[model samples]
Target: MSFTLEFFATPEIPEVLKECLRVLKKDGRLCVVAMNQKDDPTLMIKLYEWAHRKFPTFVDCRPIFVRKTLEESCFPVLDSVEIFAWGLPIEVVLSKICKENSKRS
Candidate 1:
């Protein structure tokens, strides 16, 4: 079996999953690593919140909703796990925010 990796950034996760399933071959495995909601107070979420406040629909990405989307896409999730995440210093997080803001502006 050939190996292909696809990464998508879509507001409609169900459509993305459907498209992935349609292209995947039989017996092929898919590894989906999505950052839906973080369990920790990470820089990513902080930046997202900052962006959201700046522009309300900014990066209006939707969560996968796990079970429902997978089932609908005809993909059975064999296993799932959650590892404890870490946090970053405020300066680094703020720097990232400034960079992102600059790019957008």
Candidate 2:
């Protein structure tokens, strides 16, 4: 479970998620809670992005396409929800690990 973590610290998100998938049991689940504004770009999200670009080290995390990123990393999302955190949009996602999902084309 990663809560307000990787999306900020890890530069290789897909790789990290893929590695997680590789290490988990077939039926294991992965959960992540991070800032996302792909579907809903709010003012606070924009400000965060600006801060991130201007100060990479100070503001490491910008808004991202949470579900899209997870799916692209090869995890099949089971459940996802949007929540508010300090006026910014946050996404909480739960996904299952599957060999099929891990398969590369």
Candidate 3:
């Protein structure tokens, strides 16, 4: 399964990851591409922040945060890469459904 997550502003990431795992096949690989928030703020980042201020419910997505949530959901990350896209940093992670958990479900 593959998903491109707009981690730059998503709050329900943990719940989303859990749902993804639920539908994933046994031993299936899941790939996620998320915005990296570690770098200096770009125009997109500034705009996102502005929007967030207007909407307090907005989420500021971060790579480390999402990774932790994914692990908690029983999806162990197998590989990760950082790259630049459209002047924004992006994090790509490949994870797999844990054998034991997949079997249980």
**Best candidate according to TM-score:** 2
Model 3 off-target regions past 4 Å?
Answer: 1-4, 7-11, 39-48, 51-64
Query: Against the true structure, what is every candidate's RMSD?
Result: 15.3, 3.6, 4.6
Put down candidate 3 lDDT per residue, 1-105, tens digits, no spaces.
233454423566666777777787877888877765654677866665676567756544433444655677788999988777555567787889877877865
Q: What global local distance difference test value does model 2 have? A: 0.75
Q: By TM-score, rank the candidates, best first.
A: 2, 3, 1
lDDT of 3: 0.66
* CA-lDDT, candidates in order: 0.41, 0.75, 0.66
RMSD of 2: 3.6
Which is the better candidate, 1 or 3, if ranked by lDDT? 3
Q: After superposition, how far is residue 65 of candidate 2 from its true place, in Å?
A: 1.0
lDDT of 1 by residue, 1-105 (tens): 011111234346557655655565545455554334534546666785566567766554322334334545555656554433332221100001112222332
Greater lDDT among 1 and 2 belongs to 2
Candidate 1 segments whose C-alpha is farther than 4 A from its true place: 1-11, 38-64, 87-105
Better of 1 and 3 by TM-score: 3
Model 1 TM: 0.45
List TM-score per model, in order.
0.45, 0.78, 0.64
lDDT of 2 by residue, 1-105 (tens): 544544544467777787887787767788888777666577888888889889988987767677887877777799999988888888899977756844433
